[model samples]
Target: MKAKTQRLYLVLGALVALGGAGALAFSTLGDKATYFYAPSDLAGKAAPVEAIRLGGMVEKGSLVKTGETVRFVVTDNVETRQVTYTGILPDLFREGQGVIAEGHIDPASGVFTAETVLAKHDEKYMPPEVAGAMRKVEGKVS
Candidate 1:
């Protein structure tokens, strides 16, 4: 091969190698990706074993306390979703506020077993999870 052709082959080979490495990394981390969704999305489109983020307003008068476990409903304009969490809730977490949850969906019962919950901090500042929750609460896009 000519000198330039050899260099081009080397660069192409390097690019291919890098592309393969990126694909592997993405595949490994894909399941780890957490997506935030509205109550409607949870109730409607999510499939089993699919990791997602559930966000919405914590339903007022729906927060139930049982020892360390807390149960509440998240609502979107289109639907409402029930969640049972066995852990301490955030101080910012309250009825009628935005909240987002990360976990996989259980198609059988149609409930999400959240590994972590995201609660909003303020009117302007919102963490990823918190943002999802806010959108969930907002429901309709405006």
Candidate 2:
């Protein structure tokens, strides 16, 4: 085979391999990707089937606890989502504080059944995403 023809084949083979690798990476990442959203982002939209990370303030006076299970409302001031979790909550978890819950919404009950819940660490700290969302909501309200 000519040198030029051999080089062309090699380049084509590399491109094909790279494309396959890219496709595989994207497919794997898509399966595990968790989208973040504020409660208002979900308002009026069909609930997503895949797991998601919901971030917002724990609405004041909206927490309820039972044996090994807790339920609360997470809100961005424009909308709220009911979240239920059956596990120990973070020590910082409380109403009127920023929180992030990872889970899927139940199709039948329209509730966010959380697998993990995270709370802000301190009074002066909030997740950047949640804080930005809250600022957006405040701007809209003003």
Which TM-score value belongs to model 2? 0.84
Instruction: Tell me model 2's lDDT, rounded to 2 decimals.
Output: 0.93
Best by TM-score: 2
- lDDT, candidate 1, equals 0.75
36-129 in candidate 2: lDDT tens per residue? Answer: 9999888888999999999999999989999989999999988899999999999999999999999999888889999999999999998888
Give the runs in model 1 whose Cα sits over 4 Å from its true position.
1-5, 44-47, 125-142
TM-score of every model versus the real structure: 0.75, 0.84
lDDT leader: 2
Give the lDDT of residue 76 in candidate 2: 94
| Candidate 1 residue lDDT tens string, 52-110 | 77777778899889998787888765588888787878788888877887776677777
